[model samples]
Target: MKGKRVALLALFAAVLAAVAIEPAAAQSGADSTTEKLIWDLNNQLMYIAVPITVLVEAILFYTVWKFKNNESPLPTRENRRLEITWTVATAVILLFVGVASYQVLAEPYVTATGADAGVDTVAEDEEILDVQVTAQKYNWQFNYPEQGVTNANTLVLPTDRPVRLNVTSTDWLHAFHVPGMGLKTDAFPGQSNYLLTKPTDTGEYQLYCAEYCGVGHSQMLGTVEVRSQDEFQSWLAENGDSGGDTASGNETAGNETGALSP
Candidate 1:
């Protein structure tokens, strides 16, 4: 009994060690919603599954040690209740996991969904600021259509209001994912894409290409800067560039462009 208890305790300790998942070292800010979902799910899953696993293993080990009969055939028994109990329990747990996490799936994405965001969309209403996000083989562009401002590699937004981003790619398919706000949108050539978010916290969040576009796909990176409303207006004035060379006026080496919706 003492040996069995020690084995069970060891198993439980091993299970508990895997439950604490730290955020990725390379990422910062409140960007990825997936990370938040991980935070929520890990605890529940650990608590639910770990003990079950440890207990089952402990039982198996105890049986092997206590009931080994090398000279005789192993006893075999059929227990319908045990089988059905396990099956139903597993199904119930799966169903609960799905239902409990529906909020994460239901959160509105950062998209004004143009060319398709429908005639009457909520994005039109929450349009405190409008910045156009575009994706290419390896870079991102942010254009402020209302202010006629454009730039590459960096994005700015105002606090406490809905910021609608109308986006599309001039090249292959790419995903604009920022972990902080739990937001991402696909940028497709010709066809338009949209993303919308309200940045409650003020900070800088790193952006990534969530899709594998091409050779330079992994090199693509961008940043989003959230500021106060007044500061944001000042930023619009300072970084604002004439839509003249604004037709993909990437001050950088190689850049791409696409038409964005209001």
Candidate 2:
């Protein structure tokens, strides 16, 4: 019994250690302001959660070990002081969580308020690019209204500039999610949702449809290419007016069926 108990405790400790380390290992290097904010919030919560989890589990295990062999267990007695202390502590923890989450969500780049607000929350001096995102069964269409450039399965953005994505769907519900940049917004038919992000790194990030739309949901994937301003402008000049003259005119005409290169 002693050996078994020791083994059980050791196993529990190992599990807790794995749980504590997994988040750090799984966290990707943040490449945008939104991502950084989310990561910071996660770390903040973990700082509170990890210690509480360990302490609670430790108390549970100790109580079980201490009382396991009690032949005549004493009647349970309620301690009002202990109960009140825990209640207050829990309230404080919840308050911290609520305030921290609100701070992130209230940011303009995090969650845009109002319908068709566009990039109104962005700083006056900052440059903003508008991209129209249309979602279909299993693919994505990106249209740069100002540049008159349309592309399928690939969203090209410039680094260090705010990009306002006006997202909507042509058919069913879908969600535009870019995990690396921490951008996600729902795409509803006949209604536009907006997301704002400024890419800090020049790289390719995976774009996924977070909401399951149909059987092809798993295949609904795209790429977000972040480039330097000069490179993006050159590419835009080359691709603009090649086809897809208007944002709504060529929804199904230009490369809409094209799949992202693996």
Best candidate according to lDDT: 2
How far off is residue 42 in model 1, in Å? Answer: 5.0
Candidate 2 worst ten-residue window by lDDT? 253-262
lDDT of 1 by residue, 70-114 (tens): 567666698899999999988998887787556444444322434
Cα lDDT for residue 44, candidate 1: 63
- Poorly placed runs, candidate 2 (over 4 Å): 1-27, 114-121, 243-262
lDDT of 1 at 174: 90
TM-score of each: 0.69, 0.81
Q: Could you give candidate 2's per-residue lDDT for residues 1-262 as a string of tens digits?
A: 9657755765677567758766784666678778877887887787677767766776677779888999899987999999999999999999999999999888767887644443566678987888999998778889888887888778989998888889999888999999889999899999988877788889999999999887667878889999999999998988887735443444443334323322
Question: Distance from true position, residue 97, model 1, in Å?
Answer: 1.3
Q: Model 2 TM-score?
A: 0.81
